[model samples]
Target: MNQKQLVSSALASVMALGLVSGAAAADDNKGKEKCYGIAKAGQNDCANLAGTHSCAGQSKADMDAGEWKYVAKGTCKQMGGLSLAEAKDKTAMMKK
Candidate 1:
C-alpha cells in the first residue's frame, strides 16, 4: 500500500481496537447498579439525575442525594445505599 494508505489503515485498526475494548468494559458493569448517596464528593461514577455534573468524579459534596456510584446489583440496599426516592427524603430531612 502507499504511504498515506498504510497510515490510514493503521489508524483504522487502532480505532477498531478501542471500540472493542470499550465494549468489553461496558460489559463488565452488566450486574452493577447505581447506588446513590454513597459516593464521596468528586468520586461518583456518573452523572446524577439532577444534572449537577455530566461526568464522573465531579460531585461537589459528599453523600449527594443525586450522585451515584456503581455497586453490585441487588446489594445496594444492603450496603446502606439510598435509592433516588430515599436520597431525596434524606436530603429533605437534612434541610429541615
Candidate 2:
C-alpha cells in the first residue's frame, strides 16, 4: 500500500481496537446493579439521579444515600446497600 493508505489503515485498526475494548468493558458490568448509599465521598462511580454531580468520584458526602456504585446483582441488599428509591426515601426522611 502507498504511504497514505498505510496510515489510514493503521488509524482504522487503532479505532477498531478502542471500540472493541470499550464494548468488553461495558459487557463486564452487564449483570451488575447500581447500589446506592455505599460510596464514600469522592469515590462514587457516577452521578446520582438526583443530579448531585456530573461525574464519577465527585460525591461530597460519604454514604450520601444518593450516589451509587455498580455491585453484583442481588448483593446490594445483602451488603447493606440501598437502591435508588430506598436511598431517596431515606434522604427525604433524614431531612425532616
Candidate 3:
C-alpha cells in the first residue's frame, strides 16, 4: 500500500476505536449516579458546581462539595456523599 493510504487507514482505525471505547464507557455508567462531595483532589469525574473549571481531574480539594464522581446507583449516601441539590446548597453555603 502507498504511504498516504497506510496513514489514512491507521487514522480511521484509531478514530473507530475511540468511538467504540467511548460508547462502552457510556454503557458502563448506566448503573451509576453522580455522587457529590466524594471526589478527592484531582480525582473528580467532570466539571464542578462552582464553575472554577470544566473538565475531569480538576478538583482542587478533597470532598469540595462542588466536585463529584460517579458511583454505584443508590450508593452515594452509603458512601457519605450528597445529592446534586444538597451539594449545590453546601457549595453555596461555603461561598458565604
Candidate 4:
C-alpha cells in the first residue's frame, strides 16, 4: 500500500483500539461511585463521574463555582458505594 494508505489504516486501527479499550474500561468502572465531591446543599448527594469515578464536586467547582448546573442531585446509591468489581457483580445479579 502507498504511504497515505498505510497511514490511514494505522490511524483507523488505533482509533478502533481506543474505542474498544474505552468501552472495556467503562464496563469495568460500572457501579463504583466517584470518591470526591463537595455535595449539593441539602441534597445529601453528589454527582459522581462515570469514567474516573471521581465526584462531580471538584469537576463542578472547576467548571463554575456558583452555577447550579454543577450539582446533580442523588446519593451514590449504595451505603458508601461499591468498588468497580462489586458494582459489576451487583449489576450482573440485577440483570438476572
Best by lDDT: 3
Q: Report, for every candidate in turn, its global Cα lDDT versus the true structure.
A: 0.87, 0.90, 0.95, 0.44
lDDT tens digits by residue: candidate 4, 1-96: 899999999999999999999899767656544422223433223333333333323333332112122222244332244443554555456558
What are the per-residue Cα lDDT tens digits for candidate 1 across 4-55?
9999999999999999999997998999978998889899998876675799
List candidate 1 segments past 4 Å from native.
Answer: 2-7, 84-96
lDDT at 74 for candidate 1?
A: 96
**Cα distance off (Å), candidate 3, residue 5:** 18
Query: RMSD for each model, in Å, please?
Result: 3.9, 3.8, 2.9, 12.0
C-alpha lDDT of candidate 3 relative to the true structure = 0.95
Error of 2 at 93 (Å): 2.5
Clashing pairs in 3: none
- By summed lDDT, the worst window of 10 consecutive residues in model 3 runs over 87-96
Which prediction has more favorable TM-score, 1 or 3? 3
Best by TM-score: 3
